[model samples]
Target: MVCINCKLFSQLNKSVDEQKQKIEDMSGLMEEMGKEEFISVFTEELFDALSKMIEEKKLSMENAILLLKRIGYLKTLKRIHYFGFEKISLSERIEKMIINEEEKKEEKNEKLLVGLCECYLLFYSRVPSSEFLSICVPCLLKAALKKEESEKAQKEVEMALLALSNIYMWTNVPKELYLSEIKEVIQYHQEHHNLTHLAYQSVWAFFTDRMFFEKSLEEVGVNELHLVREAVRELEELTKNVIWMREKKDERGKETNEELLLIRWFMTMKIYLRHCQLQNEEFVGLFNSIVQMFRAAKDNFRKISNECMYIFLVAKGNLSIEIEDLLNGGVVDVALEEMQQPTLGYKMMCYNLEIINSISWQLKGKKKDEKEEAKRKATKRKVLEKMEEKGYEDDIFCFNEILDILNEVNFYDEALSLDISDYFVNV
Candidate 1:
């Protein structure tokens, strides 16, 4: 499992490195060509390089700007001229082009690259605006779904989709486009489960973010009620169905298969929890089930992608009542046992416990009455030390689970469903 994960991450890194090398190689060729030849060749090469960079997710906004400058494809002055403003204006040009298409096809292509470059830049910076996303996302979506689009174009579109989903929480585009694309992605996954999981991962990011619903989803008639109803139904059905293999398998094989299954279940849990939180229905029941699922998988170290799954679960819990339940459910014992094998989840749990302890200590000084405060501090210290002795201090997942216990014990205010930051991956 570790090897496979390493291999997967390595491939992602290698792909990025390859794109970086291509941009570097192309930039070197720029000064050798004559001006006219450079413009034509640069245009061709820029399209190819940026296309690959975007597809591979190796492109950053700074990189895009740097690449354009290195190749002398367009003067920064011309880009500023087209956008009619300064401060990263690629999306601005896209907005203009979409609104008024007076440019020739060649200019339009250049504008598209600029637009894509800006979109990517906005995402990497972790800040975005509605106008910027609206200008570029619709075009990218159209390009991705266009049957006549070439393979290279499609790959760029996919990269754009992934980035769009990531920063989508910051912007508000039309929901119709997002919904349509998401539905298509779901259908594609249903047919081809072994295909790349990027698209699959992106759906979660789109759904979890609050901006998507407040800005775009309502316009698209996404029917939050319908999604909630479907999620509830799906969760219940999935919870009931489990494959039991009687044939004996070695530890590694068993662990690997179980981890995969839990990951899928975790995806379902995310959907159900997000929908429940969105609808403002009672989220307790949904969260309760999620806790149960994690508990069910608790004993299986070999069969778990512990850290990532723990991150998902902890992020979902996020100071909610679910955190309390996790603690009260004997997280220390389960985590300790799981830690003997040291799954990633167990390590994360330890970190989470540490955070909670730190927070609790900081909040203690604010309390009145030194004696009462000291007593409270002592109790909190006991829990913290116990967790430490059990080898959980460094694991965030452990701290999160401890917080869950405290929540269950009614130490803090009851949880209110907060804005679901849809940036989190669903599965």
Candidate 2:
């Protein structure tokens, strides 16, 4: 017998229950049906559903938003070539669907504007159409800049940032066109909320590839650019069970959970650090906060270790962090202790060794302040002493890999031994 439980979604209508059920079914449909079959059967219903949500008052705004959210996930399955929809009209009465600037989302609106923003994101690929950017940018900015102390407000901000992230997938977002507002939105979230992964990538790209290198971050008006440190501290509060998370890694990130948030969160920070400089105090505070997170995210140490190398590489003189800053931030202690751990996996070991190598390599470089030479030598001598004992343990089976890394980093082992002391030589 044909079952009601598996009723074909193509037979669905705009009735709230059926629409909701179909929205839920699309996830299964993506897996069960081939890509073309899924698109052919469901694409008409999908856009039609979005149109009904936009044009009709029958579906609750919550369900409408949920429908768009489901579509967003399902879109990942198909490799969309060009988004110029020929048969379907995505832009019909689209401008009227969005709430205008004068219209505050009052008690009566039922989040009508929120659904429209989601709809905007659904049609995001074609947003560059001449009139659409003008219509949508203001609506997005207004929502993006909203700062209220409630759940609903957070949702609006997230929607806007996620949308902005899409608007700015490239490094060359024009400063006056919409980027100034985009920058304001990023700063707003940094103070109040965390950005979504997509948003973080754009933010990273924006800052790392700043159009004018001579202009400081302050010059660009990201004067309160404590986003990275704030995000790191926020992570410290949210994280505890890295191993629990890793076990469900495949299942996680579908809803962009804590682990995925962290990976993207630091990408934004690392990208900024890669091309720009932070103040000495801020840089030290940021590194220490990362150390705190490293301590907290115990099982995810490998992830942290991989990211931490970027910070160390900055000391090779992106001009923000220095070797002494890393040393002061207790980097030496962490590397020495972690490198000796018998439990460390390959990537984790490589990261720890890289950290040690970066520190040693930078420490051996010439310092401009000739007066500080004696103190620098003393510091290097002390670090070498620790590495002498703890750097390379006897348990390593990855000898060739280790040797290869040694050669690449140009380890100065004039001592003619491949011991841990090989990390520094001649200096």
TM-score for each candidate, following the candidate numbering: 0.39, 0.63
What TM-score does candidate 2 reach? 0.63
lDDT of 2 at 314: 44
Each prediction's whole-model lDDT (CA):
0.42, 0.53
Which digits, one per residue and each the tens of the lDDT, describe model 2 over residues 1-427? 1232235434445677877777677556454544455455545545665556456565555665675555553443233333333245544444445535225555535346545655565445643543555555555666656657576666566655555444433333344545566567667666655554444444433444443343455335334555555555655654553453343433322322555556655655655665555444556666676676666555644555556644544444454466666666766667667766667655555555556655666577667888677767877877766656664434233443465554555433321125555455234
Give the top-scoring candidate (lDDT).
Answer: 2
lDDT of 1 by residue, 163-219 (tens): 444453445555654666655655554454422333334444455554434544432
Which regions of candidate 2 fall more than 4 Å away from where they truly are? Answer: 1-11, 16-66, 73-137, 167-169, 177-215, 218-223, 240-256, 298-319, 371-379, 389-402, 405-422, 425-427
Clashes of each: 30, 0
